[model samples]
Target: MTLIRLAIIALCMVFTAGPYAEESANLTDGGISVSDKNFPWQLVVDRGKILGCVYDNKFYSLGAILILESLPRKCELASDRNGIWEQLTEAELLLWQESIEEQQATKQEANYIGNDPINDEEARLIRYLRSAKKRADTQ
Candidate 1:
């Protein structure tokens, strides 16, 4: 029950305090709450079959499919929120998107031979493998 409440609050914060929060689009814009099958823990917004993700640990994910899409409120609730979120510049956004694709592709090309590659926008996350960061930090 407590965990569920926390999740709900976090989701609400993503809707309220996200970068695009100032924009006209909100959670009510008609997207369904979903996490990618490859990356289930990654909270994603599915609108018309597209993805929207913004912000990540250490820095802003930058360069979403559109303008701004919140990753998770915890990404912004930090003290250096402005310093990080503000980094989502027009150029950086494109760079992030392109860089993510190229970087992940190169890393996987040796073993991956499929048309559909991986999307590591969520903390450079990979599919089917949970890392140290994904582990619970507290008791």
Candidate 2:
């Protein structure tokens, strides 16, 4: 019994001190599951990253926060002033950053956007990216 208790204690210590401690409780390879115990809806994540929010069985995998504000939906303001972002290690943030970059690059290559186009924004973005690339090359 004492040996079993010691083993359990060691496992707990490892979880608190080892790599798993650095990860969010909801952060995993497939998706991040976030749902209030009382709420009917849940946050939808893909590939261990939160691209955007989900709504009422619909998933928005784009990294566009604009949709969150523009879409017509019943929304409520947060009551507390506490910051929303969880404190993550720089490495963890970098992982998600690279994922977002890859997704964005794919979208740019395809020249297609999920929502309606706005005033030749895609062309403008392409021009901007070319200019940025030129500047980087010159530098």
Candidate 3:
């Protein structure tokens, strides 16, 4: 009975720890996993070297290499600036930075409608030009 209870408790701990704790040990040695949503992308990592990264479903190798290549450069740049590069060590930072820049540029572009104003003055000018053209055509 005691053995059964202990077994049950162990099973419960394993189940409740979730993926992070269960995966953490393997992850330190680098492991890969697919997203729960089953997206075409897969996450890859090299245990102690890489924290892990998401790659295109079809181009996992290429994506992983790209991430690995860019990481050191980004870290070097961050360290030069005396910023928090050590704590921010992850392949996702590259993707996140690009995403942030893209969003910011998109927001800036969205703020400007166009050079031409669609106000009453512009409308009046357009109407005057149309009337002038009509009168000239009639004459």
Q: Which residue window of length 10 is worst by lDDT in model 1? A: 56-65
Clashing pairs in 1: 63-93
TM-score ranking from best to worst? 1, 2, 3
Best by TM-score: 1
Model 2 residue 18 CA deviation in Å? 31
Tell me the lDDT of model 1 at 52. Answer: 35
Off by over 4 Å in 2: 1-85, 112-139
Per-residue lDDT of model 1, residues 30-109, tens digit only: 23234324544343323322233333221222222223344322222224333223334344344444445554555566
Alpha-carbon RMSD, each predicted model: 15.7, 17.8, 23.1
lDDT of 3 by residue, 42-90 (tens): 2423332323333332222211222232332112212223212222234
The superposed Cα distance between candidate 3 and the true structure at residue 57, in angstroms, equals 40
Ten-residue stretch with the least lDDT total in model 3: 72-81
Number of the top-ranking candidate, with lDDT as the measure? 2
What TM-score do all the candidates reach, one by one? 0.24, 0.23, 0.20
